[model samples]
Target chain A: MTDPRLLPRTIAVLGCGGLGVPAAWTLALDGRYPLVLIDDDCVELSNLHRQVLYATAEVGQPKAPALARALLEVAPQLQVEVRQGRLGPANAAALLQGCDAVLEGTDDAVSKFAVNDWAVGAPAGVQRVASIAAAIGRRGQWMVVRSAGPCYRCLFEEPPQPESLATCQIAGVLGPAVGQVGALAARSLLRVLAGEADSADGALVRLQARGLLRTPVAAAAACRCQARGDGAADSEPWGQHV
Target chain B: MFERDPKQLFDRYGRQLLVQGVQFEGQQVLHRLAVVVGCDGSPLAQAAGQVAARYLVGAGVGRAVVPQGGGTLLQQLDPLLQLAELPSEAQPPVVQLWFAARAYGASADVVWTDLSPQGPRQVRAGALQWWVGGPAPLTDAVALGAAVADLVVADALGVEPLPSLAVLDFSDPLAPRTRKHAAAAGPPLALPADPGSPLQELASKLSETLQIQQIVAAESARCYPAEACGLVVADADGQLVALAVANLQDHWHSQDPEAFSRSARTAFALDERAIAAQQRLGRRLVAIWHSHCDVGADFSAADVSGAYPNGEALYPGVAHWVVSVRRGCVAEQRVFGLEGGQLCYADVAVSGELAGRSGVEGRC
Candidate 1:
């Protein structure tokens, strides 16, 4: 088995928002890993605190390219592949192809659940691939999900109502809090790449003022998402939605 | 979207601030930063030297260092504040300093990052949008200085517990220990769980300095099979400056066979001459520290009699500290004190800026 720790690995950062920018910036500064950035959104004035990738001057620019350029400004030696579009059920499998691991920093619950589905249902070669998700603000959760443990569907079968999940947009966020999670997510990725094993397969690690809280999660016997066919093994050609 | 001046932010929310939320020692870090705030009309926005020195005492931070020399120009105040305490307020301050700086750049000119994830929204520090927004940005010089202090504190407080330390119980963990030495040590001084207490702050400063512990442990290991002793002095305010004195155990062993017997290997007897030297240095004896080379830091029967001859508390307020030096390294330390007729483990804490999230209580 190849030791990812000794070798450089590619990571797909699924969003270029608050969580993604700092995570990617810190990771790139580590000076080892190449990054694949996927985001269709544009930089705006409001995300300055959390989404630090885009500066004030680049407000109107698309985040995918803006973030790529900004990351280069911080780390010129790092390799970055920009895919300026959203990841959906239709394109997530393709967008996520050929990466050692995936970092899901998007705020959308549906997208998070879908990525969880794909991670759990991906066919051989990609079946064991893992994705680490982090959300920040007054209230947020971070989790490491792979088939070895439990899927996101095991924890929550469906996304909550829009009113239930408040991003920094509705409920404000703290500067240091975002920083804590970003640095934490980046550390988790480095650890995973180091081939450090996690005993509790599916655990949602909650950030606290003092440290972290890890809650073990087991695959639900009744979860229907876990029973779906492996999408990566599908014989269907490109453009066919899973 | 309307733009507001950054100066207006401070006028509405003055600088005299207090840092809260991280609990306990975080406030001490803030207090140290307050002591080092830049003077009026100074070129630097703030000088963190004193702050870093008092709070960041080790980990390679230096004194008389070259300033960042970046774009900060200091603010002028009427009567400079050596220590400013803003009385408790409803909303805990990020850092409270009486707003005192003439910012070289205007608020509208300096770009502020929106901490929100919705996108980079406009962020105005002061009261312009504070009515509905998150805590105002720490925009003032004093506040930023405090933030810098906090940044260092957070870094220093991240020391994880080493598995090698099976610490000797100096103070009973089950029964909270408090030592009465100063005016502030009234009642049982429970180690504070939160900041802002006068007693806890003093107790924090009284915890032995890390450098002295390292020095004493290193000095002791060099003279193996022989105990090492030192007389450490603290300023009137309780900051320790340790001075190693020769342990006259071998001299006594050469003459008095009983005195030199097992005592030379396990015990320490401080040479009295160092006291005059220490007093001339204008430092009061705070702790009489010695090292136990081969065993745990527990005080032995001979150790007790040697310190408090005839069951009398010879050193009324001084702490007797034991540094267990095993295999040429400091393994752990335990402190004992004589107060109110009982020799109890003195509760001493070296409180730093950030509270480790693990809730693993600290000695300093």
Candidate 2:
């Protein structure tokens, strides 16, 4: 009963690490659209446990290209591309131009918020973006941000102090925990593409430790991103001229 | 008849018995006299001889004699055993005097005395009534009151004198007191439900798409020797409602096992066709599902790098789904989305038939 074409017009994965590799593989294997896999680092031995994308033999290999090749082999019909470079402020717009939605999986909160702001300032077609802060330790939190919703900055307000933020390399993470949050992110994007249209415009979903696994719960109010008077009327190059 | 010295009689029973008597104005009348013996003494032999003399005097066979030492002393030892010897009329009746002494030391000294005088005169006149009354009921009541007061003080100080006793008193009759205390403590506060604000929803949506892509790589693990792949589409709430097959053909043929390589051109064409078909249906292909077979659910290095180029060339915002089925059952299913340009996992939620609370209440 829903229009299927309303799914992502363009999709991009910005990191290919413990969390990113699995995400990119899922998208490409789905063979849904032009899927982009990007990561500047190479696969390391220390990443094998949580990052399911690389194996022992693949150590020291470029992660982006490795993930792309593996995805194509599985789904020969998928349109997959790889960019072996770091994602930062300078190239953020160019990489995100045609992307209808983006998944922010970088460990840094600063980078995540930067993605959120870019998604908001980009054209309408490029506005939808989501991030997964999958678990701090054995547990993880998954959140989805849309261009229409409050950006990451709206919920967190400010990034945590550098000393407080823990990266996967430093703090360690449970592989399954990352998998669980990542799976939730994929589902949210699919829903967005379906145009369920409501206040999905400015909503966020948080997963908490309810019992055995984390349970998803919704926030009570709209985000500050949506609260800002940045009217939806802004025109950008990526906006669809419907 | 023979006369016996009083000192000799005293010597035989003095150690085992107490002799009590009264001297009236320097005259010895032997009146109000009693002989008390230890509980282990032989008092029965002494009582028999005294009864014979009394019986002889009362039956008109008067002046019948008995050994001097046994005369009154023996009769005082046990009166009930000698009662049958008295005549119906004119019987010089037998009497018994018993003295119970409370002594603290081993010596024959009496600290207190309890007396029972057995005779018709004492019973008929009701003169011994005081001896039969024991301690009064009022004394028992006082003892009980003191015990209850001690318990109350102990409970207030939380210093239970007897642990089991306190438990019994506190819980035995009923738990009314504890219940009252618990009620005054109050209940804990509850947290608000459904905190997914609008901003979180969008973030969750974008994250879910990436998760779907991850699931695709997971599924491909089922066909390790070969390659298995599928696609998925989801609703606005990030629920996978539909799925399709992506690659149904072989993209590689190797004659040399050591030099085997993936047929990149053939794979690209197949992947493109699958993406095109999903687009034609007006549905956004949220993810591509695949299997890894025996090799396990992890993405290979080739898989990671391969995803970037193929992903950017087709869809930029879409994610991937991988379902890994091992030996017929699903071992794992994951999703992948883009974090910057790198492939990372995205979280997802599978929708069920349960109606949303707001929807069921018709609030929207």
Residue range B220-308, candidate 2, lDDT tens digits: 33333345666666545556544435453443334432444443212311356766765686667665555544222333444544565
TM accuracy, model 1? 0.48
* lDDT, residue A60, candidate 2: 79
Interface RMSD of 1: 13.6
TM-score of 2: 0.37
lDDT of 1 by residue, B77-185 (tens): 1011132222221122122211112211101001112223455433211100000011111222111232233233332223111111111111221221111112122
| Candidate 1 docking band | incorrect
User: Each candidate: fraction of true contacts kept?
Assistant: 0.00, 0.00
Docking class of 2: incorrect
RMSD to native, candidate 2: 48.0
lDDT of every predicted structure (CA atoms): 0.47, 0.39
